[model samples]
Target: MTRMIDIIVPVYGGYEESLRCLQSVVSNPQQTPYRLLIINDASPDPRIHEDLRQFAARHDHVELLENKENLGFVATVNRGMAFSEDNDVVLLNSDTEVANDWLDRLVAAAGRDERIGTLTPFSNNATICSFPRFCQSSAMPDQWDVASLDALFSRVNVGEVVDLPTGVGFCQYIRRVCLRETGLFDVERFGRGYGEENDFCRRAARLGWRNVLCCDVFVFHEGGVSFSHEQAERIAQSQEVLQQLHPDYHALVEKHIQQDPARLQRTRVLLEMLRTSPRKKVLHLTHHLGGGTKKHIRELSVWLTGGMDALVIRPVEGGGAMLSFGATDSAPGLFFSLPQMYPQLLELLRAAGVSRLHFHHTLGLETCLWGLPHDLQLPFDVTLHDYYFINAHPSQTDTKGRYTPDLDAQSSSYPLTVSLEEWQDNQRQLLQKAQRVIAPSAWAVREFQRYYPGLNYLVAWHPDSEKQMPWPAVENPYRGERPLRVLVLGALSPEKGADILESVAVAAHKESAPLEFHLLGYAYRPLADAVIEHGAYSEADLPRHLQELQPDLVWFTAQWPETYSYTLSEMLLAGLPIVAPDIGAFPERVRHRPLTWIEPWDSSPEQWLRWFREIRDFLAQQNRHARPWQDQPVPRGAEGFYRDSYLSEMESAGEKELPAVDDAWLGSLLLQSRQAEGRQGRLSRKERLLMHLLMLRQGRVGRLVSRLVPVNVQRKLKRKLSRKPIHELHRK
Candidate 1:
C-alpha cells in the first residue's frame, strides 16, 4: 500500500507568502495524492485572517482549521496533524515555496523503505547563491546540487542502512507511527524554533526509527519556512503547543540562547583586563538607561582632566557584552549575557588599541557573572553600582522606609538574595575572574572583604563633585532669617530613615529655634503623608530641584551600608555641611569633610529629639555666621581632588595589601584605589601630595628601574620601606 504525506502549513500574517506556498504545494506536477492541512493561527491582523478564509474557501483538497484564537505554531501544527489523521504529517513553513515533485518523491522514498519512519526534504540555512544577488548576471552558479550533499554530508552508513544527521527546516515528513513509538514533541520546552525539526528527527532515530531525504524531489525553499520574523510572534501565541509538539529541542535552545540572542551574546563576550596596558581595562555592564550609575565614566572622565570639555566618553560601536538590556524583572544568566559579549568588546578594544576591560552595573553582578562563557573568559574589573542589601523591606521598615528584600514567603513573590551564603557565592563568583575589585566607599570595600578576603579591594571613593553646578563663589542658596530649611532626600524607606525624620518633624519645629524640614524624592512619597511630591526628577533635574528647594543641608541619610553615596558626594560638592546617619559608607565619606554625623536613637524618642534639636541649632548658627562663611573659600579645595586621588590611588601597590590580589592586578588595584579616592572625598593638599607621589610612578618600568639604582640596594630598600604610611583617609 502506498502511503500519502499530509503537509501541515500554519497560516498567519504574510498572506502573500502563504498563497505562494499553497500554489507550490497543490499544483505539484508529480500528481501525488495528498491532503493540504491549513492551520489558521488566528493572527492579530484581521486582513490576513480574512485572506486565509477566502483562500481556503476555494480549494477542494485544502482543509481549513481556523483557531478561535492564536495558538502558536506547535499547537496549531498539533491540531493540523490531528486533522491530518492516518497520514504522515509534514510540518512546513509557509515562507517556503515548494518544488513540483516534492510529495511524489517523498512518498516514493517511504514506499521503497519499510524502516523509514521519518523523512525531510533538505534545505540549507546559509543562503549563498540561492537567489540573484547583483552578480553581474554572469554565468550564474547552479543552486544546490544534491550530489554535493551526498559527497560532503554523508555521515550515517551501514549494511542496507542509509543514515544521515538531523535535517534543516524546509519539509519534514513525520511518520504518524513514530508518534506512537517515541511519543510526541515534549510540550514543556520553549527552546526551539529553527532547530525543532532536527530535534524531532533525532528523537525518532533514538526510538529505532529511520529517516530519508528525498533529494530527487528537492524544494526550492524560497526559504525561512516555519519561522519568519512575524511568524515568531504567532509562534509565541502557542508556546504551549510547540512544547507539546517538540520537547527536548526547547531545552537545548534555552540553554544555548535564553529565548533572547542578545542575552546569550552579552554573556559570551566579556574580556579580561589587559596585563600589559598602562591603564587596566574594565568592562562596564549597564542593564538599562541606568539613572545614577551609568554616567559614572563620564563624570570620572571630566573630573580626571579638571574640565568637562577636556575629557569626554567616546562609545566604541559593537563592543562589550553581546547582550544589552531593555527592561527585565529578573537576571538573564551570564551564559546569555556579558560573558558571551566579551569577544566583540575585545575586538573593538583591540581596534581602538584599548588594553583592558572595566565592567560596571547598577544591578547585582551574579546574573552576568554566573553564566559567562568558559572558553572565552577574560580578566575583568568590576564596579558594583548598587547593593540589594541596602534598605529594609517595605512591609518591614527599618528606621528609614526603603524597600529591603522581602524575605518572608508572602513578601518574596520572586526569588531574592536571601542569606550571606548566597550573597557570598555570587560575590565570590563575580570576583573569581576579576583582576581587581573597585568600589566607591570604605564601608563597601570593608563589608565585601569581610566574607571575601584574599582578593585585592581597591577603594575608588566617589567624588564630592557630582552635585556641583557651575557658579561663581557666591552666598549660600538657602541661608535666610526664616527657620533653617532642613532637607532629607531619598526614596521613602526605613533605611533612609525618612519615617524617623517625619516622626521628629513636629517636635524639632516646636523648639524655640525651630527648624523647617523639607523632605524630597520617593522616600517621602507615602510616609510623609504631609510631603510635597517633587514629581519625577531624572538625574539632570535632581540638581535643579536641590537649587529650588534651598535647604540648609542635603542629607544622604541612608541607614544601610552604601558603596559610595552619589548623593553624599553631591552634597559635599555643594559646600553645604551634611547631617547624615553614621551607617554604611556615609560615616567614612562625610566623617571629616565638614559634616556632622548623627547616630539614630537606640530606641528612646528623647535621644532622637536631642540629636534632631542639636542639628537644627548647628544649621541656625551656621546661617547666622553667614557673611564670612559665604565669602570663605571651601576648606580644602574640591576641584582637583578627583585628579589628585586618581593619580595617587594608582601610584603604588604599598597602598593596599589584600592577599586576594596577587601581582596580576597591581596596576588595576592602584587605579581603582585612586578612583575610589576620587569618588568620595575632600582631600587635603598635604594628604593629596603624598598620595599622588606614592601612586604616580614616573617613566617606563626600565627607566624607573634605572633611577632606583642605589650604592647600597639593601639600605635603599629599608629607606623606601621606612617611608611614613598614608593613613586611611577616613578609617572610622
Candidate 2:
C-alpha cells in the first residue's frame, strides 16, 4: 500500500505568511499521497478566516478547521493530529516555505531506520537546524534560489543523517506508529506552546524512539509567526512547567548539545562541499546585473555552472557588493566603498574558493580595481564588449559622423578628458595582464588588434539567441493592394538611425511608395504619423509583439557600426528576410543567408529607399518562385560555440604560474596615467597660455590675434600636440 502523509499547519495570525505557506505546498506537488490541513486557532482577524475558507473552497485536498474558542498552538496541533490517525504526520509551521522533493526526501530518511520516529530538515531559522550554527538564526545567502539550493543541499549531504536529541517543531515529520506510542503533545503541561515538541520528543526518547535530521533537504522558515507578542511570557511559563514535569530536562538537553563535538564540524564540511564540490569556482566581475551585458553574463554563468561553480559579483547602487549564483540565485547585498573595499572583496573571493576570474563590463565600477589584473593572482580573462579602450566614445564614431580607427585619429576629433585618459591607460595595462582577451565577433577582434595589437585574443560569439524559439513559423505580412510592411527594432536614438528612419519614412510617404514603416522600440523624438510606433517591449514581450505585427521585411539602420547585433541574430532565427548595412559584424553575421541584402555604410536616404523597394520586390519574386523558408539549416546556437571556445581557451592557457606583481612597475604606469590626465586634451601648454593672453587683450588686439592665428591653425597645433605616439609617451 502507498504510504500517506497529512501535513498540519496551525495558524494564529500573519495572513500573508500563512498564504505563502499554503501556496508553496500547492505549487510544489509531492509524489506521496498527502493532504494539507490548516487549523485556525480562533484568530482575531476575520480576514484570516475568510482567506482560509476561500483556500479550502479552491483546493479539494485542503481542509480548513476553525476553532470556536481560543485554543493555543499546542492544543491546535494536537487536535489536528487526530485527523492523521492512520497516516504519517508533518507538523509544518504556517510561515515555512517548502521546496520540491522536500516531502519525498523526508519520507526516505524516515524509512532509513525503523527506530527513527521523527525527522527534521535544515532551515534558515530553525533552532537546531539553523545553518552556520546549531541555535542562532542567520539569513540565508541572497543568491540562493529554491531549485539551486535544493540541488546543492542534495549533492552535499546525500545519505548524511545525524541523530538529534529533539526534532525542530517548525517542520517535524512523525511516523503514525511513533505518534500512537508517544501520544499527542503534552497540552496540559505546556498549554500555550514553546517547549511542547521538546517535551514530547524527550518522552518518545524514553520509549526508544530516535529523532533524526535529514541533512539533504532544506526548508525556509520565517520564524516567530504565531504568538510573537507573548513569546517571552510563553517561554518563561513553559520552562517552569517543563522543569516541574522533568527535573533534569534542561540539563539533559544541554548535555546532549555539548557532547556532540562533530556536529558543528560536520555542518561546516557540508556547507563547504555544497559550495565547491565537483566544479571549478569562477567569479565573474561586471558593473551592473542588467541590460545586454547582464544577459550575456547570466547565460555564460548558467552554462558554465553545468560543469563548474560560477558566481557573479557586481556593485549595487550607493556602494556595496552583491553576489549572484548563476542567473537566478543572488545573496543579500553588502555595501562598501570601492577601491577601499578591495581587500574585503578579495577576502570574499578567497572564502568562496574562486579559482578563475572572468571580467565583463566594469564601466561605473572601474575605480574599485584600478590595477586589479596586476594585483590579482588568479588566471583571468577579459571580454571586450565595445571600443572603450581604443576611443573615448565607445561607439568609435567622431563628432563629424566619421569612424576613427586609430587613437591619433580619434584624438584629432574628440580629445580625452583627464579621468577618461587614465581609465584608457588602465584598460591597456589590464589587457596586457589578461590570460586571454575574448571578443564577440571577428570584426571586433580585428578592431582590437588594429588598435591594441599583439595581445592574445580570440573570437567567442555570445549566446545571444533565446533558448526556446517563441514563434514557430514566419507569417507572411504581405497582402495584395496594401503597402508593404517594413519593421525596425531597437531604440530610436540618433546613433541608432532615428534620423535615417525619419528621412526614409517621409520620403516613402511623399513619393507614394508601396511601403509602411512600423517602429517597435522607444523613440526620443516624435516621428511622422505615417510611421507607426509600437513603443518599447520587454524581452519576454518582444516575440509576441513581432508575431502580432508581422512585417514583410526587417531593417537594420544603425548610423554607426555594430559590434554584434543581437536583434539581427533573433530576426535570422525567426527566418525573416533582413536588410542591413555592410558594416561591422552585420556583413559577417548575414554572410551566406538567403534573402538578405546589405547596403553600403554611407548609403544615402534615396539609396536606402531604392534598396528597400528592390529587396521587397525581390522577396515578392522569391515567394512567386516557391522558395522554402527553411532552405538552409539554422546557424549553430551561441552556447555551444561559447562552451567550445571557452574550454579550448582555458586548456590552452595551461598551468603557467602568474608572475608576482611588480609594485614599482605598476606605480610608474599609474603615475604616467595621472600625468596624462593632468595634461590638457589636444592643446599644448604654450597654446593654452597664448589663448589665455589673447582673451585678456582688448578688442583690437584680440581680434588681430584671432585673425592672425585662425581657428584652423589652432586646430592644427592641437592635433600636432595630441599626435605624440602612444608607445613613445608610455615609454617616457
Candidate 3:
C-alpha cells in the first residue's frame, strides 16, 4: 500500500539549524510521497518566521502553519499531528538533518507490522536511539558525511529494528491509527516537552502497540536548539509526572540497557565502517589471561595509531572469544560463542576489514583457532611470548617449579586432555603457516628454534619507552642503621617464584637480617605479612611507587626461563641495582651491568638472604649519590616491528573456501565438550551471587556500603572478591 507521511517539523528557534534541517530535507527527497508540513509555534526568534515562509513558498509540496501565541513544544507537535487526519505524521525536531530517503525508510519500518505504533531513526543525539553510545550525545563520526553514513546504514541494517521502551521524539514516526487510540501528548503534564513522548509510548504500549528504533536510517541532531533555556526545569517536571503515571518506565528502560539487545546491530554498522575504510586492519589473537602478551597487543595498537587499526581476539573463560577494537584499553569489545559460529565468525571478520592476522598467544582459545589461518586463507604472523607453542608448561618448568632442560621429563605432570607431543605438534602446524615469526629476545629465538628446528625467526624486543634516556645509576638508598629495602615486581605466581619470595622473607625474619621486602605486584596467593604486598601496579604508576619505596635493590626470584620480561625492562630503565635468577633472558639482557647480580635459578632462601646482606654492605660503602649516567642505543622493540611490517598495505582474504562442517555433528561435539568441561547451562549459584554483588556495586546498596565501610576494609573486600579460591588454584 502507498503511504504518505506528513513530516511535521515544529520550528521554535535556532534559525541556522532550522535552515539546515529544511535544506537537507529538500536535497534528499523521500521515495515515499510525503508533504513537509512545517509549523512555527510562535518562535521567540522572529528571524525563523520569514525564513520558514520563504522556504515554504519556494517548495510546492511544503505547507507552513503558525500560531499567534507561543503554545510550547508539547502543544505545537499535537497541533501538527492533528493537522493531518488520515496520513501518518512524523514529529521531526527542526534542529535535525535527514538524508537519503530517511522518511521512506521510517515508513517501510512502520509497515513491517501494524502493531508498531511509533519508530525512531538512529541519530547523533537521540538518547537511546543514539549511535556509537547509547543514552549519550555523540558527534557524527568524522570520516562520514550524513548522506554517506545514512546510505551505509541503509545498506547494512536493512529490515532491522530494535524494540525500545519509547521512540525518541527528535525523529518519531507516529501512526495515525495509534495516535487516535493513544490520544495526543499530555500537554498539561509536559508543557514544553521532555517526557511527553515516553508517556505517549507507554500509553500506546498499554494499548498493545510497539515502539521501535529504525536501524536503517541516520539523522543528525543539533540538540538543545529549541527550549534550551527551559530544559532543566521542564525535564524535572516531566520526569515527576512520568514517575507518577508510569511507575515502571525507568525500570523498563534500565532493563533494556542491561540486556542491550541493540549491541549487535551497532557493532555490525561499526564493523562495516571499518571494512569499507582504506586503512589496513590487523587482528591480534591472544589469551584471555592478561600478562605481557596483552600488554604487547595494547602497545601495538597504540603504536599503529594513524598508521593502521588493531583488533584483538581473546578467548572467554568457558567457551567463547571476545574481540576488542581500536587502541584504547577501555574500547568496547564483542563476545561470541565459538565452534558453533566458527564459519559466521570468519564472515564477520571479513566484514570487519581484518586484512591480516597476528597471533600473540592462543593457549586458551578453541581448537578452531589452531586452523584459523588455513581455514580463512588469511596470511599471518606469530610472536613467541611464552613456551606454550613448544610445551604444555608456559614457563618450561619442572614439577618443582625450576627451569628444566629436558622438556619431555615432566610431560605427564602437566594436566591436559592431549599428550605434550600432540599439543606441540598442533602448535607447530599452526606456526608453520605464519608469514613471519618474531621473538622479543635472542634467548627466546634460540629456545623456540630448538623445538621447531628449521623455521626462521625475527628478533624484536618489546617496546619499553618512547623516550630513551640514558641509564642513570641512582644513589645508594641504604642509610647506616636501617634495614635495606628490597622490592619485587610483576605478578608472583609459583613459576614467578612466589614461594621463593615467601621463604626469603621468612628467613630474613628468623635470622634477624637487616633486610625489608616489598612487592609491587600481587601473588597467586597471599604471602607472609613481613613481605609488604603493594598489590597490582600499572606501568604508568610504577615510577611513582619506585620513588616512594626508595629500595636499595630490586630482586627477581623467577624459577623458570622467561621469554622476555617487561618488568626487567622497567627496572633496567629505572637504573636500580638488581638481583635476578641466572636462567631466562635476564642474564642476556642485564648480565653486563655493574652493581647487578645474577643468582642461581634454584637459590635457597638463606642464599638469597646472604646476597641481600652482601648488597646492603656494598651499598653502605658507596657515596650517597655516586654513579654516573651513560647513554645507550635503544633496541627496535615491538613498536618497531609494528611500524616496519604491519604498517604496510595488505590484501583482504577475499572469497576463501570456508570449511563445510555438518551442523548436527559440530553441535554434538560442542555439547559433549561442554558437558565434559562441566560448564553446560546457565551460571551456577556462586556465579549468580558474584553477579549480584557486581550489580549492587552499581546500585544504591553499593553507595550505602561505600559510605558505611572504611576504604581500607572495602579494598580488602575487593581483593577477596577478585581472587580465586585457594582450592581452585591448587586444582589448576
Best by TM-score: 3
For each candidate, the alpha-carbon lDDT, in order, equals: 0.48, 0.69, 0.77
Q: How does model 3 fare in lDDT?
A: 0.77
The candidate, 1 or 2, that scores higher on lDDT is 2
lDDT tens string, model 1, 1-732? 555667888876666777888877776655666778888888666676767677777877777778998776666666777774578777777866665455665666666676777665534321211111110111111222333322222221111222344444456777788855666554344333443555566677777777654443334455544355654564564445546655654574444322221211111111111111233222345433344565576455435432211111112111212222111112121121233443433333332223234556523343433333232344456665655322212122221233333344343322234664665475576565666666666656565565567776666554543335221222244444576666776554455565566666656645544555677666522434333445555666767887788777555555455556666655655566566655566665544343345564233445666765666665555543322223222213333445554344231222222123222333333233234333334444555554554444343553355334432342234224432223333221
Residue 409 C-alpha lDDT in model 3: 42
Model 1, residue 360: C-alpha shift (Å): 3.0
Candidate 1 vs 3: which has more lDDT: 3
Best by lDDT: 3
Worst 10 residues of 1 by lDDT: 128-137
Against the hidden reference, what TM-scores do the models get? 0.39, 0.57, 0.66
Candidate ordering by TM-score (highest first): 3, 2, 1
RMSD of model 3, in Å?
9.3
Error of 1 at 83 (Å): 72
**With candidate 1 superimposed using the best TM-score fit, by how many Å does residue 683's alpha carbon deviate from the native?**
48
Q: Model 1 scores what on Cα lDDT?
A: 0.48
Once superposed on the true structure, which residue ranges of model 2 sit more than 4 Å away at CA?
1-6, 9-217, 220-274, 316-322, 328-332, 368-374, 400-415, 419-424, 464-480, 624-641, 648-732
**Candidate 1: where are CA atoms >4 Å away?**
1-282, 286-291, 301-354, 361-377, 384-423, 463-481, 506-513, 538-547, 601-606, 618-732
- Candidate 1 TM-score versus the reference: 0.39
